[model samples]
Target: MNIQLLANVIGHEKGKKILINAFQNNKLSHSYILSGPKGIGKYLLAVEFSKTLLNNKSRQASPDLMVIQSTTENKKHSSININEIQELESFLRFTSANNSYRIGIVDGVEYMNYSAANALLKILEEPGNKTIIF
Candidate 1:
């Protein structure tokens, strides 16, 4: 995929440049927080950036990327939990085929339960070489 083209579509060239430069220099922070109003492309940027970072052209087919979001079941909204967080940690342990980036994107993290928030905190405290965006 042409990342430059994608970046133009998003119209966040400055932000994208900073991220790309940091990524190229191996100086990216362990975590990132992107907060804004709905429909402002925060999620889109995360997904696209993740795909680029992981060197995967197709967003759906990227094994190096995991997106965590809220779900609804039995008419009740579900939030992130310990199991999910544990799975994320486990996913990080696996090495990429060519040592690509391992990325996790937590969407709507405000919906996480108390335990899940704590778990996420613990993960953030020790991010290893993986990249997580909240």
Candidate 2:
């Protein structure tokens, strides 16, 4: 697979190369943490990487892709909570269609509260086969 098609983001050549190498080499881990300052296209990279893993470009239409992000309710920013983590866990429990990878992308992970973080940690520790979380 061509790296350019996998992740379309400009810049972050190093990051894109790393992800493409992992995919080509079949050396993907169960979990990955993409940390950097905000507005650095981390989420975009993750989504594109997921598209490559799942062989699908339309993330919204893919059952194998799960994305968790902070929510805004009543003009207030709500941190990612344990319930969302639990939902992600449930989503990952199912078998991936076409036996492909079940990819989970958690954007704005820094907004997760303590309980939510712990829940996510549990998922990371015991991610099932063919499950990849970013």
C-alpha TM-scores of all predictions: 0.82, 0.89
Residue 52 error, candidate 2, Å: 1.3
Q: Tens digit of lDDT per residue, candidate 1, span 69-113? A: 766332244477778888888877687656877788887776777
- Give the Cα error of residue 119 in candidate 2, in Å: 0.5
lDDT of each: 0.73, 0.82
**Model 1: CA > 4 A from native:** 72-78
Q: Write the residue-wise lDDT of candidate 2 on 1-134 in tens digits.
A: 64555446866788888877887898988988888877888888888878777777553668899999776433244478889999999999899987998988888777787898999999998999999998
Clashes of 2: 0
At residue 44, what lDDT does model 1 achieve? 79
Span of 10 residues, lowest total lDDT, candidate 1? 70-79
Residue 134 lDDT in model 1? 48
